[model samples]
Target: MGTEHRTDEHRTDEHRPDVDRALKADCASCFGLCCVALPFAASADFAINKDAGKPCRNLRTDFRCGIHTGLRDSGFPGCTVYDCFGAGQHVSQTTFGGTDWRRAPDTAQQMFAVFPVVRQLHELLWYLTEALKLRPARSLHSEVRGLLERTERLTGLAPDELEKLDVAAHRRDVNALLLRTSELVRAEARRGGKDRRNRRGADLIGARLRGADLRGADLRGAYLIAADLGGADLRLADLIGADLRDTNLSGADLTGCIFLTQPQLNAAKGDSATRLPPELIRPAHWS
Candidate 1:
């Protein structure tokens, strides 16, 4: 998702100056890498099928979407929910030094190949940065910081080096660390309670869970698509990789929830009553 100007209230401790600016999408400073480097099939979310390295038809000469304001109305809702975690600008300006694929035609293939790799690394940086801000995960801060720095360095590597890097192996290492952080934070939230739900990777699609008590729940990688989660108490829940598409989050309290990204919120349904972590803004479509 493109970055918006957030007020002071939206700037929480997780959004400290050190890493906040680096983890947000800045479309103005980018060369529309996402529109050209990523492929999308003609499904419910996209109006047309597009291949990697080929610019979307809506892309303008200035590298902005021609139908950005009416993306959803024009049958390109998927574009509204995609976030590159700031990799687009980093790749366009830093990796390739502001030379767009159109100008440097010879570098087009390598630039496309390197964008996704940097996107993944930047995502891990997002998680590691948040993990460092969790007071309950204080003991693991040093390790998280180390990994965050290493991931930042990886993002700055030359395109060829990044293409050859084993990102999957690196992701495994980062996931393990994040799991430990999740355990520490969730344990603290459920210290005096006995209802510790371990629904990690559970298939709860279309389940009736309105008004459910899901505080401190381990819901990592759960398939919660189209689930009724209205009025649920989801504080401190581990929601990393959970499919929240079309899920009802109206009136649900997601304060302090871990690993909840803007794209996930954009895909789900919510209302003004839904409470969110300070770092994330309510999606405009939620209204």
Candidate 2:
């Protein structure tokens, strides 16, 4: 993956303080390594267009994006929606000691490799911490605490150690604990006993489902790309790993859809062609 290093200036300045503070606390010291490490397509999502390893044209000497203010208007709307959940800075400054891939090209690759590993750990931390906050998930508290400690330790690994880390094994262990936590929480949430279609891997591409009742539906790994799901009721829906590419969700209610992240959402397509919830943003890919 070829990506150009960018400064923090490309990121949204008007971030929600609660989120910004948490993300910053976890990752403010590092530079924008992900932008330079990951590869992106020349879709509407990016402005000037770049290769995977190439630094963005707007990147400045200090590693900030020159077009930060105009990122949306300039055609890089996708960048506006991306949040590493605090992975970049943590790896750049803390794990790598404020060093950069430029000064040490070899280390840049290592930094890039360590980021996703840490981000996944952090994402789990976010969920586990949230689970602990729920009264019903109390039974899983001890397990969650243990997972947090392990996850935290992984996040703090040095670049060399992090690059050599076995992230998959850790994820497997974390998944087991998360599964137990999920079951506990799901059992507590009251739901209507409706005989809904449990379509775990249905191919519903481009199918019209406007204003459809889909409460408590199981759509795991389903290919629903380019399907019209406007005004669809998706309360308590399980959408894990579902291929939602080009799915139209205009006026769709996803208030309780679990495990949906900005990256997943961005990878899927939506537009003025669709009306997303206020909380979500329009990815450049959709344009």
Instruction: Please provide, for model 2 over 124-194, each residue's C-alpha lDDT reduced to its tens digit, 9 standing for 90 to 100.
Output: 66655544544445767777777877777778877678777888898778767755654544443334565
What is the overall TM-score of model 2 with all chains considered together? 0.72
Candidate 1 accuracy as TM-score: 0.94
TM-score of each: 0.94, 0.72
- Quantify all predictions' global Cα lDDT against the true fold: 0.89, 0.64
Most TM-score-accurate candidate: 1
Q: After TM-score superposition, what is the CA distance of residue 213 in candidate 1 from its true location, in Å?
A: 0.3
lDDT, candidate 2, at 104: 83
* Residue-by-residue lDDT tens digits, candidate 1, 1-287: 11223332212364346577988999998989999999999999999999999999999999999999999999999999999999999999999999999999999999999999999999998988888768788888888888988998999999999999999999999999999999988886677867887999999999999999898899999999999999998988899999999999999988878999999999999998888887788888886
Which segments of model 1 are wrong by more than 4 Å? 1-16
Candidate 2 lDDT trough over 10 residues, lowest sum? 1-10
